[model samples]
Structures are given as structure tokens and as C-alpha cells.
Target chain A: MTLRRIFSFLFLLNILSCKTDSEILPSISKEDIQIKWPDYFPQPEYNFENNSLTKEGFYLGKKLFYDPILSKDSTISCGSCHQSFVAFAHADHKLSHGINNLQGIRNAPGLYNLIWQKSFFWDGGARHIELQPIAPIINPVEMGETIDHVVYKLRRNNAYKSLFNKAFMSDSITSQLLLKALAQFMGALISTNSKYDRYIQNPKMNPFTDDEKDGLALFENKCSSCHPAPLFTDGFFRNNGLDSTFIDSGRYRITNLPSDWGKFKVPSLRNVEVTYPYMHNGRFETLEQVLEHYNNGVLQSVTLDPLLRNGIALNNTEKRKIITFLKTLTDRDFIQDKRFSE
Target chain B: MQRQHTLIFIILFIFFKMKSILKVSLITLIVIIGFSSCKKDRKIDVNTEDPSIDKPDNQEKFGTVSIVFSSKAGNSDLELDSVKYTNAHGDSLTISKFKYYLSNFKLIKDDGTVYKQEESYHLINRSNGKTYTVELENVPVGTYNSLNYLLGVDSARNTSGAQTGALDPALNMFWSWNQGYIFLLFEGTSPASQSFNQALSFHIGGFTLPYNCIRSISPSFGSQNVLVTEGHNSTIFVNTDVLKMFESPHLIKFSQVSESLGGAIGSSISDNAANMFSIASIQN
Candidate 1:
């Protein structure tokens, strides 16, 4: 080719190489992360601002999430506590770890498609997904970093400067851009394709085992009130016959009242198989121990939910069945999602 | 060098696009002003007469009201029980200071029209005085019939997340774990204990079920028809003397109040403490 034509050809290549502009999705896009949930699920309380999915924003949030720059000494990151392998919950530790090996007051809930959550955390403290990260970022025992400080540091970084520019229209790292990106990632972490979902969706094709069926029945009768299936939670805080005196205070921490003492948000059991050592404080070491607590060890308190006040009665065979049912909540698809892995 | 040129072109394009947006906004603003003036009095017969002719300064006339808050604690003006900080049994219980949240505030016009405050949720530090004060601005020169304000931060902002300045959590008004904000910080000793003898503080708030604390307060002193302008101060006050907080079956004692009973404590103290702070406490 002639030199002039070669130059023209290069120009055309650049134009062709440039992918279509990442326009705001009119609906969930192929690149747009999908939020998997069952059909029986209620319409999400969080309204998407006209299908507000963006790749740049989600990736930036993911990068910031894994980066420790959000911490005070740049030591700990959100990933420090919320590792993906453990379903975004603090693995093994009774309490979440933070900056300088600091311990948090409550166990960090596994991060996921929180747009459906009416409330967040064990105490139901965080009302909005966008605002939830601010708690960990600023909590003294958590990251111990202020939103403003995070914005300032991101503004100074060459990497974040480009990342913020791609995520937001401007490189100016306001709280809005930072939060929007985080919310994008959090809202997109949906976990729906479990064996239980498949079994329920197609009862005949993907049959549940006899043991699993028995477990399901037991779960429906005993655990359905609080740990309602589908979402696996009713989204209300309850004492669960945990204690009489308010050690953690649970929901009562937000309101200055007595009735809500020790009440905590009923967590969804989507990945209970892998997310072991359950309960608000990570007090129960095994699933069997938790079943025993529900079966007979439930502590009596004034605020305890009446349904669970008597403790869920079950035989040894029934307990084994319940464990099998609980295992069905695991979504290996989520654990293996390329989008979430480090 | 070629890649650098491409980046430069893209950057310049974005800059030009932003400038175009600014230019469009400016043109729209001029058009709006032109249309408004043209539309306001379209059929004027050389302006027959401006009603202001008879009362020359009537249209420009302004009046001021100073609000005073006094509670019937047997005759003393309703002041906070004490200026002492918090030291209840719970360490999270200590309050360095107390502040009230008021937002989306609007002054109702006598003509049923509303003149909204530029920054509606007015954060008045009651610690300064029994009376919280604000000056009305660009009010379209009207006689306002009354003042109306949300007793706490609006639900929109509560769910919106980590706001700064007056809404900053450094104010200690925010609960980091539980997402909702504590609208009122009532840090006073309850007569429930003997450790140094003080009342327990009731940090009453929670904008959710079983304990929503968002309240509406119109100074019970009744409406004051006042004209406002670019240069005038409006005073609003609140009285905590209602004896309403203790009206509940359970009395709040400092010895018993802990962080554990957080949002639920709202029901006991909200009715009394919600109206405890007044907007118009003095004449400005």
C-alpha cells in the first residue's frame, strides 16, 4: 500500500478497534453483570436509575475493593475481611478483622446482590447498600478511613485517577462517584443458581433426594418463619431466644428502646454450605451445634420471637435432614464467577 | 507518539462537550428569564397601575418575628436540663454534645404558595441557645403565613448515605452499623441510678418500623404572618418542658439504658423529645 493509503488504513483500524461506547444499558447487557434471583423473589426495593449498569464503574469498585488504599495506613482492605471464597464474609474469625489487625464489633455479612435487602448487617443497621460501605470505611475498628480521605487518596493515585475517570464522567473523586462504583459492584454480586433452585424450578427433571425432601419439609415447618426460603430470610430482626440482657443490643443500637434488645437481622442462607460457623457473633462452630441450639438450646429472653421461644423440636434423623437441606443453598456458580475472583 | 495524539484528541473532545453543555445551560437560563418576564403581565395596558402606588412600600414591606421557647417546669424558660456531657453506663452512651436535625424546611405563604428554604434541613445547634435563628432569603417578597419543618432528617437523605458538613457523622449523630441516623441526641441524666446521681440519656431515633422518629413540628405558638426579604432573620424555638418523654409506662433511667436497646428506646422518648426542640425561640 502507498504511504498515504497506509495512514488512512491505520486511522480506520483505530476507529474499528474502538469498541462501541459503553452506553447506559436499556436492559441487562451481555457485559452487564446479571443479578440472579428466583421468580418467587419480591420486586427489589432498590430501583435502578433507568437500568444504571456500567462496566467502568463496576470494575473500578472491584479494584478499590481489593486495594488496601482505603485503609488508614494502607494496611487492610475490605477484602481483608470479606474474602470471596467465604462468600464475602470474614473467614474463620469470630469478628471481622480490619486495619492494624483490629477486630470489629460485629461479624461482617457476606457481600452480595444487596439491592434486595430491606436492611443490612445482623442488626439491620444499614438501610441502603450505597451507605453500607461507609460504615466499614469509617468504623474505628474497621478500615478506619474517612470517605473524604479515600476520595483524596484516589484523586492522587495515577491508577485511580484513570479508574475514576472511566467510572465517572470526571476524574474528580467525589463521594457520589466512589459510592456509585461500590454500589454497582455490590448490587451486581447476585447468587441464585443453586441445586435447591434447580430442584424447585423443575421438580420432575431435577429431583430432590428423599433425604433432601425430608429436610425441606422440616425446614418449612421449623425454620420458614424467620429463615423463609427463596431469599432464606424474612428481613426482620428477632431476638431468636439468644439472650436476656442486651450484650450486642442488635436492632436496639439504632433505636434507643428496650424491646429490640438482642434482636438481629435474619440472614439469607444462600451459601450456608460454605459460609460455616454461623450466627451474629460466629458463636456456633458447626452446623450441628446450630441445629442443636434451635432444637433445644434456644435461650429465653423477653424479646424472643414466640415462634422460636419453645425452640424448634426435632429428632436426630430430622437434624441430619435439615443439614442436607441447608447444604442445598450453596451456589457453586457464585463462588466460581470470574467477575468476583481476585 | 501516535497513541498520545489519540488520547489528546479524546480529552479535547470531552472538554469541548462539557463546554457545550455549559453554553446550552446559559442559553436556556436567558430564554427562561425572557419568557418569565414576557409571560407575567402579558396583557398590560401600559401597566394600568401597580397596586404598590397606594402603599408605596407595601410590596417591599417586611416584618420580623422573634420566637421564644419556654417550658412549664414551674416557670423557668425551657432550657436543656444540664450542659454536662454523657457518662451513662454504656461507653457508647457518652455524648460530647447534642444537636437536632431539621431539613426540607419550607415557609408557607399566605396565598397557599410555598417558599422553600435553599437548604431545607436547618441544623440548629440548640447548645448555643434555647432559640435557633435563620434569616430568610430571596423569598419573592411575600407575607408568609407559617413555618413548617420535618422534625428529623428526611427519609430520602437517610437512605441516600454518608453526607458531609452538618450531616457529617463526626457530629456523632450517625450510627455507623445501623444505617439510620439518630435525629435527636437527648444526653441528660435519668434518675435511674446512684452512680454520681444523674439522669440517663435517651438518644431517640430510627426511621424504620417499630421506632420511626421522623416527626413534623409547627411551633405550637401558632402562626405569625411575617414578610421576609434579602436581609432579615427569622427566629424559631422549641420547648422540652412537655413532661412527655416520661409519659410512657417505662421510665428511662441512666443505669439501665445501654446501646443494646438502641432504636427501640425511641418509642419511649420520641413523643416528648421530638417536639422538645423549638425553631423560633427569640425575636431577631
Candidate 2:
């Protein structure tokens, strides 16, 4: 009778141990989470060798991205400036509005296809995607919070501690891990599912309209030098002839070279339809104005792009068609994806 | 028969306990042996040319070296925000803050073999007393003649992603908008006024070509050589004179150019700042 009781007790203990083990392991499979991009797209600059992507990490990143706790007074989050609806661009704001109603110098550019970007911001100051968030986070006009205080705040919060533990599997929360988490979410933002992409994949099933087709041809002839297909930006710094005298010497500030004056990073024309109030300083509000600037308003300077020296001549009909083509590049599914929602 | 059954039960319990103890001891023995072999392999890897390699009886082949930086202004010790010091340019200034980065340390032995410290990045801040001494461990036991280190962070680390510890961007030693570390930061107040509030700030940093301020500093030890032994720690005392920064190759006047952020001026300041460090003494 004693032997039988001991065997039953051992069996119960084994069952309980198995139950506890199962509870300890995460329910979500790591394989389910992946960074997917189009086959036609170029190799991304940021390969996730250092920071392996997982569901928990991405979720934690999403949490951090939307949380206002990153700010000094807990007022603004990354989502405040980079709203997902307009492809992560601050729509209608000429300049970024920050803490204490302070105005920033430059417009907050849209955040998408970040893994492909070699550099960040209008001046191309931030070289790495992982280090890009530090610029806005510490900017007195923006978040108005130091990274030390941000780390301290996150450590105090019980919710963040659990999330960080789940993601990094470490008891200690660090800025490296925090930045990595942020990078994971930002790098995963691959927007390649637009109507244009569909049309490229299958011309027969998803045919472009006559106007779009003409616009595509015109864009290829006129704008494809700077804004290439698949990923709209060539990721080069150039002076697009906006001003004769630069109030904001864009790339020159970083390089401190006289030749780099007025040179700003060429922004991706992807989702340019909704990401309005465009240019580095948000000088142009509509696509028509942007096209008009390219057509006739090309100001000459020492650093003006050699290709745009004799500006591309496009008629009104060509401009209209180009706008139609640009609209097809907007990815509706990316903006509405539930995984990226707050 | 009941007594025999109890005896059998006791024997079985003892047998199980002995087996478990034997298994645990076996595991422990394997772990110890594994660690010892790993340590031996690491030692061999670190110092292939060590004299102790030929004589395997000598177990301790590595020692520790500590570089202690003592900041001074002219003849007196540097005191922040209180004491006034006159620079070579004859401008009296009270230093509020002084910080700089020293990285990529390499110790050269008497035999010309170099022992390069991995990830040797240290931020020396005047406000923080703990950062004055940088201790390096696992240095091959030898007589080192000279020490070489970079006055600023290398260009590769500047471009590389988020870093921790001394190179952490949160330390405010980095420029957020420009995306590079401020290698040497000197902020103070002076009576010679041109700027607002009579402030003198020199944020020196640049890693790009032609304007790169990442200077290579090799402080001479004079006649003294750092002797590292198995059980002994060698401490090298280095004196960093702040007045040398103002007047060396270039004379920085507070009245003319009080404030300089990274550029040609910053690079020139870095050139002057490179002459600041000198080896004072070595205690083995």
C-alpha cells in the first residue's frame, strides 16, 4: 500500500512539473513573426543579425512606440508625430510641434521602409536605424526627455518591466535593448503592397489605367533618376533647387562641407498621395505644387543637381497623369494593419 | 519477516541516495575539469609568446595594469566651478564642466609586442571622481615601455549603432542632430565677454575625413617603465594639464572664439588638447 501511494505521488509530481514548464514557455511561436518584403526590393541596409526579431520584441516595440512615457512630461509619443494613417508622416504640420508648444526646425518625415534607408532625417545625420530615435527623443523641442530619464521611467513601470523581460529575457533594462526594441518595430515597417506593386506583379490581373500607365512612363523618363521603382528613393543627398539662399543648410550641417550646402536627402515618393505637405521643410502642400516646382520653379544654385540643371519640361496633362500614378503607390493595407495600431 | 522487509526498504533508500550523490559528484568533477581546460586554452590564446608557456609550471601568466588620470590646471589640481585658473592665453576662467573620451588603448612591451585592450572606451568626466582611474585586467606579465590611446572615439564606433557604458548616447556627450560624439567638452565662465553670459564652451568632435579630431596620443614615461608581475598591479599615473589645451600648437583666446562646436576650429582645439597628457610616475 505504501509503494502504491509513493508511485502515485511521483506521477502527480511529474504532471505538475510538466504543467509548470509549459506555463513558463511562451505560447506564441517565434517562427510566426517575420519581416517580409517584396522579392523585387533591394537588400535592406539593416540586417537583423544583432537584434533577432520575435513576436514579443515587436509587441514590446509597438508598446514603447505608442507610449507617451518616453517624453519628459508624458505628453508626446513617437506616434504623435509619426501617425500610421498617413504612412507615418506628420500630416498638415509644416514643422514638428513638440513639448511646451515648441516648434521644431525641420518637418518630421514619414517612417516606412526604414530598413532600406542608409541614413535618417532630412540632413542624413543619423547613420543607423537603431540610433535614429535618439535624435527626436532628446531634442528639447521634441520629446524634451533625456535617454537616461527615459530608461529610468521604463524601469519603474511594472508593465514595461514585464514586457522587457518577455522580449529580452533579462532582469535589467538597458538603453541598448530599448533602442533595439524600437529598431525592431521601425525596421519591420515594409510598405510594398500598393496597387503599383500589384500591377507590377501581375500586369494582366491588376492592370493600371491609361492615365497611370502614361504617368509611369513619364515618371520613368523624368523622375526615375532620383526616385526609383520598388523603393521610391535612391537614398542619395541632393539639392532639389528649393531656395537660392539656404536658411537651413541641410547636409552641410553634418558634413561641414561648402559643396554640401542646401543638399537634403531625397525622400521616397511612396505613399506621396496622403503624405502631403512634402519636401524637407514641408514647403509644398500639394502634388501639383511639387510638380510645378520641378517643371518651372527649379532654382539654380552652385549645388543644384546636374540632372535638374535644365529642368524636365512636363505639360499640365503629364502632371495630372503623374499625380494619378503617384496615388497608386499608396499602400492602404500597411496603414490599416492591426499589428501596427495603437 | 516484517523486520526483513524494513531492512530491505532501508537498503533501497540508501542505494538511491548514494546513486544520486555519485551522479552529482560526477557532474561537478566534469564541470571543474571543463572550466580548467577552458581557462588554460584562453591563457594560451591570450599570450602565445609568454615565457610561462615554455615553463608550464608557472600558472599565473597575466597581471593587472591601472592608468590613473590626474587632471591639473597649470600648477594646481583642477577644481570645478570654484577655483579660477589662468590659461596660457592670459584669460582667467572658472571651469564648470570638463569631459573627454579616451579609447583604443594599446600597451607596448619592452620586446615590442603589443597588448591591445578590447573595447577600450572610457569617458573621463571631471565631475565624476570614480572615472579617474581605468583598470585593465589580464595584461601579459611584462615590462611595458609605452602606452598609446586615442583621445576620441574611432570613426567606426561613431557610425555604428547604439552603444552602452561610456559611449552611451544618453550621457549627453553625443550630438543628437549631428550624430557624432563630442570628444572633448570644456564649459566655463570668463570675465572676457563676447557671447551671452560671458560663457566659454568648446564642444570638440569630428570623425569625417580632413576634419577628423580622433587624435592618437602616446604619453612618454621618461625613464620609468611599467612592470607587470603575476601578483602585483602596476599603476601608471598620468597628468592631464588643462592649460595645455588652450595653448599648444594653437592659442585659443576667450575674447575672440569662446565657443566652438565641431568643425575646423574643433579639430584645431583637438590638436592642442592632444598635448595635454603626460606620464608622471608608475607604481608596480
For each candidate, what's the DockQ? 0.19, 0.29
Number of the predicted model whose DockQ against the real structure is largest: 2
Each candidate's B-chain TM-score, in sequence, is 0.57, 0.79
Q: Pull out the clashing pairs in model 2.
A: none
lDDT per residue, candidate 2, A1-342, as tens digits?
554354345434534544554455444445645688878998888987678887888889889999989889999999999989988999899899888999898888888899999989999999898898888899999999999999999999999999999997789788888998999888888788999999999999999999999999999989999999878888899999999899999999998899999999999989889887999889899999999999999999999999999787989999999999999999999888777867
Best by TM-score: 2
- The TM-score obtained by model 1 is 0.69
Q: What is the C-alpha lDDT of each candidate?
A: 0.67, 0.86
Weakest 10 consecutive residues, lDDT, candidate 2 chain B? Answer: B1-10
lDDT of 2: 0.86
List, residue by residue over A1-342, the lDDT tens digit for candidate 1. 543354345444444333222122123443756555778777887755622667777888788788888889898887888878878877777788877778877777787657889777787768877777878888888889887788788888898888887666574777667777778787888887888989989989989999999999999988898888678988888888766676788877655467778888888888877676678888877889888988888888888988887888988999999999898888887888879877
TM-score of chain B of 1: 0.57
